[model samples]
Target: MAAASIFAVIIFVAMFLLIVLDKIERHIVTLGCGALTLIVVFGICMRSGKAILGTLAVGDFFKKDFWYQVTESESKGINWATIIFIAGMMIMVEGMAKAGFFRWLCMKIAYMVKCRTIPIFITFMIMSAVLSMFIDSITVIMFLAAVTIELAQLLKFNPVPMILSEIFCANLGGSATMCGDPPNIIVGTSLGFSFFDFLTNTGLIAGICLIVSVVFFYFVFRKEIVTENGAEVDMSKFPNPSEAITNKKDFITSSIIFGMAVILLVSHSATHLTVASIGLFIAVITLISAGKDALSLLKKVDYKTVLFFIGLFIVVGGLEETGILEYIAQFIESISHGNVMLMIAIILWISALASAFVDNIPFAATMVPVIQSLASTSGVDISTLAWALSIGTDIGGSATPIGASANVVGTSVAAKNGYPIGWGKYCAKLAPATIIVLAISTAYIFVRYL
Candidate 1:
């Protein structure tokens, strides 16, 4: 217990630092840290007894035992369904990327914004945010960043503001839908919130934030953009705008499948099917359609992220098993005197600050069970807390250059195009706008859900 506690603390601190620095590859850092966590957990498992570890049936973590003890008692560690679902989603994203869908999409967006830099910038940000509500923020950032670089050079403007705004909007947009962000997906899967529930509640907040972000960005970058000569921009130089794409047919097919998959996700309550099962169905259809090429596409998915998620869950599981999480939740509840609204506020603010300095994915992963336990005891709605955490962690990414993967990737792409987005400058352009919009979102959550 002592060893596990100390190890968790160290890993938590290191992960937070790594995310805030934004210098290293997050997947790589997560892999390293996840491996270390497994090592520590295996040690604890060995010290306790083989029977305790043996009792850890592969699929049992999905059951009531998720909150069980680990003192040489029978235990389980992994959620196989979650692991498989993540693996499948990664493959699907890769398949789409390989099919030249993203590039084509980017080209189309670029064309629509042509010769009108500010409108183009605003339109891209708005659309990117909307796309993020359906797809992963990381994927959206990858596509937008690539196009923003080309558009930046052609327009003779900095890509920093537009890229920054897109990251801001991605978080906001993702907050609007259950499938939008990884944290929301975790919340949806664990708590059984349907897609419409998220859309109806958080979606409205997201729309408000989107409008707020646009207006905020206008003020932030109004001067730089207005001085630029938009008419002189040449669009033809950005050839094949779909250069990063590979297979168009597979792209279209996968997109249609993805759309159906989302519709099914949103209609979860009506169907009574698990997200994991839905993911499996998608994987099967994709494999049938793409065949050997589908298998090849699996390489594009970030498998490391899956492992990292598994490891984080196990680590948090260890905390729950050791009763550490329970203790913290109790401490928080007592401090707030069991006031659910106050508790929600504390969690939201803390999550935002912590997320700004930690990979929101892992941070959200570990917090799920913690918040679940907290809500179970305090009578607070876990769904609202989940949405709040998702909003904080997502939009908080825009508060700093190292805050989110999208910010890192977007800045990197911009730098390559000679418009470097330094930490200080990024903060100057993004922090105020993100803060304002996020504040509006938090207030909405408080008034509507609390």
Candidate 2:
């Protein structure tokens, strides 16, 4: 027990420092931490005369050993559904970009506002947030950030506020649906919570947070958005809307396929059509429409992110497999005195606060086993607690620069537009809003569910 606790703490500490340093790629950092964790925990157990190998399979421990070992380990641990969904979504995204769907959509929105910057800014926030509910937050952040930087150049306003709003709303919006955020996906699959179950349970809260988010943006950025920077931005100089809509048929097809994919993804718990299967089906049909490009789209997908997830899973899995999570769960349970509501609050608060500092994916992944143990020992129904964890960690991701992938991408987008958003300033803008929402969410879960 002592050995497991010490090793888990070291792994967590090392992972946090590496991420904050910004020098190491997150996947490498996580993978290294995972490997270190397995060695220390198991090495200690083996030295202590415990038959650790008897408990852990050769296939699970050795990643490069056998093909079936690697395959089975991944099949059991990795979220293939997410990987497939991301791959399929990338194809649709590529088609959209190639078809100029994003440019067309932006131009239409810009044209509708008649080049009014404030309204255009608000529209960007709403659209980014809405899209994040179905698509990945970081992808939406990248597109929105690129477009907003362009808009900043077009509108002659600082891109900082617009980028910040987009990032903020993206995090908040991703919390709306199970398929929206990585942490939410982890919660959904591990807890056996349906996609609809996530949306339904947290739907109202997320909606309320969305409304609050809009208001939060208005106050936070009102001065910046209304400021006259240099001169009027001539939208007429930007690319014409007509030129942006080159492939109307392809655009329509991609849109339809994406829409159907969203429906299928959300209906997964009922239909049992995993996101991976749906993605494969979509990828095949897309290939049939667009030729070999659709099949090749898999190469463009973010395998690194998937690898990061895999490593993080193994890292946390080692902790659980080594009994660290059980120790922490027992400690939490003792402190809570078997008070279910107190345990829920602690889980929500700890997960949220921890998420703000480190990557929420690993944070949430690590918490899964802890929460499960707490649930079993304390006699708590983890269904609502899982939702609480999802909401807090997903939204808490907005509180800091290193919190989520979307935050990092959004800030980078801001930098590209010559409007640098430093860690200090970005956190200052987001901390208050995140704290308020987290507090409300924490109270909401305890009061209603408890």
Candidate 3:
């Protein structure tokens, strides 16, 4: 490897290991790593006169050309579109939360399940997956986890498996839509793939996986659903599902904005707007129409996550600039030997295994460029490659509690509720199911796409 490439690899691996350890705040680690990448990796390249900024003379800072070059370089380092799209979705999902959207959904699902163990398990897991298709999976899990715990308490059964299944399903459902998961948001906005494109391709596969996964979980969890206290919940004690709405007017407004975001995503091809623009535009419209609560809604966005992505983008961009990703791409190509099916299979399984342990956002962000590089080198279909990676990252994320944001949120919720599911317990139960889902995804990709 070249000196810059080696340095890039060192910084990236160290960062990945730190992140996996979760010893420090993720944003802190990623931003620090990003700065290290620029100072070390890019600095080495700068010494060789191959860096993007070239020589930054004092006079050059005043010139428009120099500033333009700097702006272009920064653009390459951080995808503002992906960052903006994530912020927009965060605000939108926050708005929905303020409107009690998730609570309403949970109440409705709770009612329909009739307090039966089988129906409760099936309905909530399916709802978690289906809701995650559009809503943020973390938010979906928060409401679902809390509510499922209550249901479990009343029905006299353990809720740990239910929460795990929900986490798995939420991550799985996230794979089916462009805005469903953070990884999807990163990949979709970066690649210019529309919501419709995702739904037609990976979305089809996610739906199939949902059905099969539901069956797999049902069997595993059936024994746990046995009620030790009582087999029935007092459904009469629950409030009417409509009572979940805090404000009818705000509910309608938030729903319209959320729905409009999805519509704009689907029709972006005709509207000639970028996916990033569509998301941000809807977010802005939401705030403007939200009246005085706009600032509150804006404040609800997890800026910590935004900063994490920003830093992560810089770190990955450093790898791209220093040619580390290209090297990995070449290795993948050599392993696959120019076969598209082998490439797809390799990308899918590697991503799945890696994402099962790593945070999927950083993993997806890193792989995005690698996929592009592989596409160019091996002349493979970029869409197939992206879809395979998406499926891998999405479902594989649920194998461990720390793997994805939804899993993290779900576990935290479980912990807070006194149900504290350990990583060993979580993986022991969900990892095999994740493997099954991954196998199903690989076959689906091979049979359907190839």
Using lDDT, give the best candidate's number. Answer: 3
Provide the clash count, candidate 1.
3
Q: Which ten residues in a row have the lowest lDDT in candidate 2?
A: 65-74
The list of candidate 1 runs beyond 4 A from truth reads 1-57, 60-77, 230-248
Tell me how far the alpha carbon of residue 393 in candidate 2 is from the true structure, in angstroms, after superposition. 1.1
Q: Model 3, range 253-312, lDDT digits (tens) per residue?
A: 888887787787777656666655766787888888788999988888889888887778
- Candidate rank order under lDDT: 3, 2, 1
Residue 388, model 2: lDDT of 77
Q: What C-alpha lDDT values do all the predictions have?
A: 0.70, 0.74, 0.81
lDDT of 2 by residue, 373-439 (tens): 8778777887877887888789888888878889999988787667788988998889888988888
* Candidate 3 ranges beyond 4 A from true positions: 47-76, 226-233
lDDT accuracy of residue 32 in candidate 2:
86
What TM-score does candidate 2 reach?
A: 0.85
Cα lDDT for residue 60, model 3? 33
